[model samples]
Target: MTYCKVCSLGSDHPGIVVDEQRVCNVCRLDMVGDLLVNYRYTQEVFERFQHAGRNELGPYDCLFMYSGGKDSTYMLDKFTTEYGKRVLAWTFDVPFESTHAAENIRLAKERIPATFVVDADDDNIKKMMREVFNRPAPRKPGKYLDEKLPCVSCRTFFVIRAILHAHRNRIPYIALCADPQQILTMESNVREIVRGFYTTFGVGLTDELFRGEIEGLLFAEDDELPEIVFPFIAMRHTYDPDAIVAELKAKGLYASSPMETHCTLFPLLNYYSFTHWDCMFYKLNASSHVRAVKRNGGDGARSTFSLKFPGTLDVLEVEGRLKKVTLRIAKGEGTPQEHEAELVAAFRDLGTTETAARFVARSFLDMPAVAADMGIRLS
Candidate 1:
């Protein structure tokens, strides 16, 4: 049960390799030469694009994705004030968004000078999620599902929708405020990948719906495409969540801490991932937090990073309950139905509808086999 002294990755965690010095492979990689050189290149490219975008004759310099969470709110402010860009702050109003996030959007609208837009295509979004959940499990489900298909697919929806808006409106750049770890390079083949996602996962969608919205847009010429930029990575911003919240509050911009704001389905997703894969989606970010703390000359031991649940769930309490459930299942101390009933109850308590909670609880029928594929034993 040894753990990395730096990132705190336990030896039992899937695929984790800790050396004798009690440091995990991820932490060790950080010590190697020039880890962020690619990010530096991305920053340079972003600056060039920003300059070009400003010089262009367009109504908006960037279509900033404003989730009203701490990071997005801070980045929205920075884009408007620090960068002095003519920003179009766009919020994709997903049905599962936290109530507090909605309030934050209202506050940001009053404080920020950007032109704000909320696109609430609730029906389509719900339809997409239902398709994602109802799709047959892949034959060889791997750790990829641990990332949560619903979350990833929904974000893909956001990206596609943003691209459509920016392209049609002739916005030169589309800005996203994803943290450094989540920042992905918009490579030349991105459109192909995006297209493949639709063809594969979006099979349930009608041809008319696909052709009307995605087909031609995805095939647009590279020159005509809006340049996608990640502001946090471009600026090499050190992401301190606590500082971000404080800064937003100082500006009279109402913002909730990460734990207090997210999609309502996040707790159920976390429970699903943890129960099946023995890991949470935030595991990678937790390690990143430790590295950031040590880089800033602070003790990694003192870092406050931990498994987080979205919305109003008390993280420590949830962790305790999850551990107990894990123990009971591993020891064969509870029947499968009893264990599922308990999880469904927990999800319901966390604000998910009882039907949705039960659906998630039952969704694990095939997960034991998937877990075995990844060399994880599920009891």
Candidate 2:
């Protein structure tokens, strides 16, 4: 006697049903479904420069957000070597970033001496990581769709840093490695981008979380601001993943770490998103079905294989994640929701707050030191 919640039907829908829930087939459209139906951008409009020569190149024109990951490396190749832009590649190193991430940066440097700007405070990162895990909260809806869910924080930091760096360094534009699908989800317009700066981290999030680590970073109006570009958006549909990976490797531009592992924080975040399944670390197995589930929610953490990891989930790791969740919930940072008891218990037992607080304080202190090292003036 189940009735559809979306369309209010009884057992007669034409499409494959979901979760045996009474949700109507019409209303069951996930984010990807909506994207395909409503937001698919025309490729031609974005590919205006596809056939152009090196004539468009400008001095100190754009900044590329490089993470030394596969996608980013390919984007760098497309822009600098192919498009012939005077590009400055900027890398922001966050807390809990793996050693492999650092190595990848080194590899990117060998291929192209891009301007690498790293903002890393291990103690601060560890602390925030702890807080993020301790809390019980619902993340932004868009987070689940991102290739790397934990990137919400890291991405915000880089964008803010990039905008500020671009302003101070006189770089006229910022080039994102994000594809069309990603940017569209974040809102493609410049106005949306500015608003996103606030919304993405959850409304009213202060720079003081990291102790005013981002005091001077703010967006300027279009009339007063520099340009920000996304050269990859147009190529999202046309680019072949295999071809790009091969090309980068041939150029000796492969990331220094294992090709499959890019962002280290992914495993932790994925654990919660796919809670029914095993932790992200376990899902990293070559045969693991994480990627498939990510593309389509089928078998989406429903299988027993996904359930096995919780038993082995480390107390500290759970604490760290819960702490982060608590902070986001407390701050009303990204998304909104009710607090969960299990998450609170984990955080309370781990002494993560003390750790995270110390990290925040340290990060605040490190800002001036980093600015001095980079020879950038702080107001």
Candidate 3:
């Protein structure tokens, strides 16, 4: 398959358009004059917000989401040392988080002088995740659902929890460390959206329970809320992931390589998406990494971080083969049962325990129902 020379986005991917110059539509859009102007305006606004909120009476200037990954660690250092902000660093302790990540958190707490808090509501979080996994697939699954539903829902939960904490403590700002490719702006109707999600998922919430738990957690219609900001996008310099990792290691903030810091469930979820939909959940993010490296005058292919499975398997190589298999299956050259067997093999290769694999596999057993809900054929 052909790929854009600039971003390495494949021509075969849905909604991607490549030009004669071997550049992708995203690159073309990036060249637009107004878009650049708007980006500058966003930076200016963020600066103004930071300056104005510096003298607020709250104990902390910002509530920073700290995952102990390279990106978050870098941002925490900047907030505390560079910007001189009084920060409250909050970590959501997910059950499947890597041991390396936990160690990184311990190191960062020792190195960075910030009020550190780790939220561990395992029972409630597990219950919510069970509902997320078992709920019927969406009628109109938006882009990235097959790969990102669990991550996105979990993020939403934590973001809401962060907002509630910030509001109660009178913190004026909430800072997130998502890279430019993954950043999303807070919408005005976020409250409504959160309520809709809980109702739709029936997330262990009766009417009275929702009123007691959700209503109190959410802000009123006219209540002032903490302003949400993406620090990576607002910063002036390009976000070099490699540089960030190197700096973190040099400062004794983190010890592991980037590939070793993700959630344990990440590989399993990516395997599921690739087998079921012929799409790598991380394909776009990987492409974005390549583009960013090239923009910084680095070799895109050589500098790009490749996803690693538990064993010796390289994820990108697997993606190429999966794409071909998907095409063959579409043209009646492959069998669904063969694909199912391949998925089982892939799970085994990931080194998952038999019981864990079976449990997660059962969660997606209604793929046909999910496909029907989305008005598509799985095979």
Among these predicted structures, which one has the highest TM-score?
1
lDDT of 3 by residue, 111-216 (tens): 9999999876665555555555555543322333435666666677677677778777877777877765454322213365467557545655523222345565
lDDT of each: 0.63, 0.47, 0.61
Candidate 1 weakest lDDT stretch, 10 residues: 301-310
lDDT of the structure predicted as candidate 1:
0.63
* Candidate 1 off by > 4 Å: 1-41, 53-57, 134-145, 184-193, 199-212, 234-237, 290-298, 301-320, 323-379
lDDT, residue 259, model 3: 50
Candidate 2 at 339: error in angstroms?
Answer: 30
lDDT digits (tens) for residues 158-275 of candidate 1: 7777877887888867787766655532321336546756665654573333446666666788877776777777534445555777788998886555545666665445544555
- In model 2, what is the error at residue 9, expressed in angstroms? 20
What TM-score against the true fold does each predicted structure earn? Answer: 0.70, 0.55, 0.67
lDDT comparing candidate 3 with the true structure: 0.61
lDDT of 2 by residue, 41-76 (tens): 323324433443342334465677787666678787
Q: Against the true structure, candidate 2 has what lDDT?
A: 0.47
Q: List the residue pairs that clash in candidate 1.
A: none
Clashes of each: 0, 28, 0
